[model samples]
Target: MPTYKQFPLADTAEGLTEADILSWHVKPGDTVAVNQIVVEIETAKAAVELPIPWAGVVTELHVEPGQTVEVGTPILTIDVDPDGAAAPAPAATPAPASSAPAEEEEMKPLVGYGSKAVVTQRRARKGAAPAPAPAAAVAAPPAPAPAPAAPRGGYVPLAKPPVRKLAKDLGVDLHALTGTADGGVITREDVERAANGTPVAAPTVDSGTRERRVPIKGVRKMTAAAMVQSAYTAPHVTEFLTIDVTPMMEFREKLKKSREFAGIKVTPLTFAAKAVCLAAKRTPDINAVWDEEAQEIVYKDYVHLGIAAATPRGLIVPKIRDADSMSLKELAESLTQLTETARAGKTTPADMANGTFTISNIGVFGIDTGTPIINPGESAILALGSIRDTPWVVDGELRVRKVMQLSLSFDHRVIDGQQGSEFLADVGALLADPAMAMTY
Candidate 1:
């Protein structure tokens, strides 16, 4: 007899309740091997690829792409014994509406499985017929007009719940509009185009492009929530310092040719990170967390430095583990690898956890400076501004020098104004003269 196996959504990270099915690599009837990646899912924290535990032939897919599935729900089924002898047929019987306890008991938890039973109900199919009424019930009122006919080849459109809601709100019939997505799945953009009476194939400006609305989910949704929590929960105090970083800029040029830093692509941000690490040693309280529930301040001994990187999805901060312990060459190499992994959308949840302090390099985008909100757990954040050539008074002589601005935002409940100002000044001083970092 063939053994049927169901693959449940495992806990990819802590506090992950659900994940969106981004795409499928294997379909029904496809032969798969153990540990082969079969699907990709996007959770609130990161995008992860799931591997099948047992080698088998895919029997059925229980979930569709773009659908959010709760943890522990069966997303796909497979037959482990494809060549096994067929079992004797049973007498004619009606299948139960819900799975039996025997079937549930047969489910073996794979490695990393988070839960045992499914928690979410699958959505009902669009235009499904109502269940038959009891004989004693009165005749139901006449059914409403049937939905607009499906597209060619009698294909009904596939759309997510939000897109369906948008179509209904705009008085547009989804079945009538041709979809531009893969496998005739309707998207929000398709519905908006239909509402504007434009051809779904070609969306042009002539169709009155007033505004475009994007649904927030995944990374964008998580980022929004974190920002709101950080802004409201913590009292923030921002202090700015303008400094001439001419010495630091010159030091970077010399370091580029040194054999110790030969392969590293050194930049101003690299020097800024080094300076922060060195300054953090002098001001250890700056690298701390506010423990609200515990009613105490938690000062960290080491730094898991968070370098904020903006991706196509949203802002993600992947940390460099034990950054204070690494040399400048090691820091530069780790920073390069961490950022490349983050931008490529491969940063894992663990890579983002346990950050002691953060740095937001807004200078990359030509931004001068802004009061950056603190990362959720961390108490302080440093923002680096654009480097420009400006006239400065050096020893009472006006000369052109490389100048940059630094802004530090700290949780006022944990750090006083004096402490925050002193921390910012130390960072500015180190950056203004790279050799000053050694004195600390």
Candidate 2:
């Protein structure tokens, strides 16, 4: 009378169709508890861990590692009543009607874990009748409610399995801190904060291998498709400008020592972000979207600034919402947190959605400048070049100054050359002289 339950792959986020199985934590005959992580999956947006809903012994693994499975497909099986009378009834035998109610009540799958449609039982295979329920059924006792403070190394916290793994890797005890997420769930940020900024190491490749082939999926595949669609649909035009940023660099050093800016990271990108916001106000076309279906040009009053970050997974752009309204100190802090979360692979899909403008800092890699592609749904993107000591004329005398290159690429259908030039010039002016922001 052992009751077997198959767990289907769930949709972790909106519009998630399929996922690549990255790894599995449990196997056949292994005992597992409710809410324990059973597998890790990589969707189009981010990596997520799926937790089991039933406390049972694992019976079978439907899929293996590196397999791509669609949502609602059975991935794992568990025997919830392992100590029942005996094995399950065969598919040919029909169980007594009296046992159906107890079996249905005790063996319901956890809600909101699979496809949009609730699956009450396993789908029957082609030309085959469905499996039969056991002749006798026993209802398992309900799991005890979670305690406020779980014992060290024993309590399963109110966090996702991946978050728990992250906490373990960072040497953080989840029991010590309170959850800030909705319904008192512990988030990755809480674990990171408790760990005091402990860095996660990137995966390393074998140095002996001459060549390697990696499957194109996840964020990289999505990025590729978007870039191709953008390049072919949008008419692209790039413009470049070189400017002296000696004044801006000097101002940055001064802000670092000031009481107001203490403990805040003030990088060149922070200044560039502020300049983009200011310049977008002067030339709104740069912060516009070309609506093809609606046949209208959509201009945004608020700015969702996107910073292009290169991480181990791939290139991702996480946005700072309503950045134009924030102060310089606030922008700096947001930029720091955004980049850190992105690099740590903790940025959610919502963080990268609905970006109005994007800025790519090529200078961090010591590159001068290159024409950056316009992000989809965005009209323009700016690239900041390296700051080099170059000889320039200032008030007649030639002197070495901190010089940088600026590149702006825009969709020509939305932004004309004049507007693009004005936006680029405005940003350059602000960076050339930080005091010019007062005029904007």
Candidate 3:
């Protein structure tokens, strides 16, 4: 007999109401030892990989990838009784595993673990319309294109199905293409090349006064709620400081060649991230957040620096847990992972929960500086502005320098101007000479 135990999602931290499982590292019936990574979950605070607490076979995958579950929700069931079997019973009639689609086997982490391949089992039938028409009730342009006036040469006709699909994906005007295949059919070569490389400037799509609307739900709904809560509850005060980030820029360039940063996207923001972590260490109060109902402040020893990233979904601040202890290489890797996970819309509510401070890099979008609002539950947020070549005096001589601005926003209730300025100054000093970050 196999004994079963269900694992509930722990409160990765206080007030983390929910989280999304980004991927299941182990699937049902797979054996996992204690401390083995079982799943990667996105919380409001950060993306963290959960370790299985017991050594046992993964009997059931309770939560699907991309499914949002409240804290304490059972995610996986592990069978771990001393006398029980480690593996689950096999299916009655199993199909050959080799038959599985090649695409699914070579999976990328899409939403959660890779999705199962959708098989439309069929075969070619000559003299049949290339594809069943999109149900008659469905509306669309009649011919889809105004077919080329005449056929090009005697290249074998590659059915209309391939031609139409190619046209749709490439946004090509099939009607305008001079077909290279026999009977005026398009070839796969032409379409594949066009789709693979940099997208050709597509012909303007005519909207014809059509209004497109997207419903406010899911991530968007959650973001709106969080923003409303943060904007109204936190008393925001933003301060700006412009600095000549020459040293930081030079340091970044040097680090690029270092082995630690070879795979990471070394940028000005990475230095800003280090600056935030170091400044927080010097003045712990700047990193402290206010406690609302208790009317006291909660000071944190470890800094979880949140990087405010703009994704296709909305604004999400995924934190780098224990930023104070991370080396520059580790920090770069964490930031890289955060941005990639955010764009994939895999950021969970839990990952955004316990951020102590945040850095919003408006610099990526070419903005000089702006007063950024506070991320709720956090005491402060620092914004890094664009790094651009500007006229400056170097050694009392006029020279062009790469300069960037910083904006620090703090909650007035928990942080005062003196404390905020000191924190900002410390951060500026580090950026002005990042090698000094190690001391603070």
Candidate 4:
């Protein structure tokens, strides 16, 4: 019998149960190396590429692009090698007997470290193995290795690992496709062309809805569950405060050309974020979370400030670590970096963890204000509103200027009405007169 090894999915990050397989990298009969990107899966926060643990000729593709797989379900199979003739085979675990139902089976890697590590196989690093056999010939697998991508032309292009895999799975030549955007780089559309039978239109989706529903697998499934859980568990208290932000508007204009805010987008939210951090500092209780398991309150010393962004998959809050220590310019740059990462689905798991406070800048989407929900584990969140011209009284005279609203949502259990109002007032005061922020 030709022995075969199955490569099951594993939890890529904490609290993650399943991921949506956005795309696959290799097809049946194709040679793959250890650490080679086998698939791209969309998690709640970003799209991440997962590498194959073992090197081998792909004997079967168990899931198609867009299928969601559980954390330990086998998505594909590879032929294992021994004696350096083929790729190292993943260690095998005896299957649970037939009486075990699909849901009852452990949908995870076997828990033991040595004898139970599912998919313990490793592969040869790039350039370490001898050249593969000719395209038409049966080739020996690469040598033993751990998984790891070379940096391309000064920039790692933003495609997910699965996008690269999609090209491979569809037999589409990735290098042949031309980038429609800057520097002529190829995109997902380029590889998708081969999958649809006709050449793909660059940067565009297939005309009309020959709709495809990718099974919600990895991150998407985990994220949806988390959002639903948070929505139900938290007792949300939302309070809105609108202010004449004309002064803040003027402050932003002055900062844009100033050296202190050099090379940064001096938006009201940047100032709002700084204000929130300062306010949280003054109100320690609101900055803390209820650790239900430990039966203790956890107060974070450093702020992992989360910025909520809506991506194609869903809402992802990628945090900016130690945001309190950064200058206005630094915060602006970080915002830009996180936004791009969120859009590309490349923000790592580390980027999404440890958020002590969250800011949902709905202003960018041109909304005035909204009663926002508190992110689970965090006690408070602020919604930054849109700036628009409105008539307001200043020094007993009415004048038209940029005005905006701010909404602060806090956990009522930890934060009283007085404290929540004070925090909101502090954020409003800073925006109304940003020069006042120097005191903190």
Best by lDDT: 2
lDDT of 2 by residue, 161-239 (tens): 4576588789898777676664446778888877886444334557897875666778889889889999999999999
Looking at candidate 3, what is the lDDT of residue 126? 34
Candidate 1 has an lDDT of: 0.79
- Using alpha carbons, what is the TM-score of model 1? 0.78
Backbone clashes for every candidate come to 0, 1, 16, 18
Best by TM-score: 1
Every model's Cα RMSD, please? 8.2, 14.9, 16.5, 13.0
Candidate 1 weakest ten by summed lDDT: 136-145
Instruction: Give candidate 1 misplaced runs (Cα > 4 Å).
Output: 85-110, 113-209
The 10-residue segment with the lowest total lDDT in model 3: 101-110
lDDT of 1 by residue, 62-148 (tens): 667877666766678777768866452232432244433112223445566454443221221246433333332223222222334
Q: What tens-digit string does per-residue lDDT give for candidate 4 at 95-164?
A: 2343321111121242321132343223323454332333422322222222213344544333334565
Which model, 1 or 4, shows the larger TM-score?
1
Clashing pairs in 2: 1-86
Q: What local lDDT score does residue 429 receive in model 4, on the 0 to 100 scale?
A: 87
lDDT of each: 0.79, 0.81, 0.69, 0.69
Off by over 4 Å in 3: 1-211
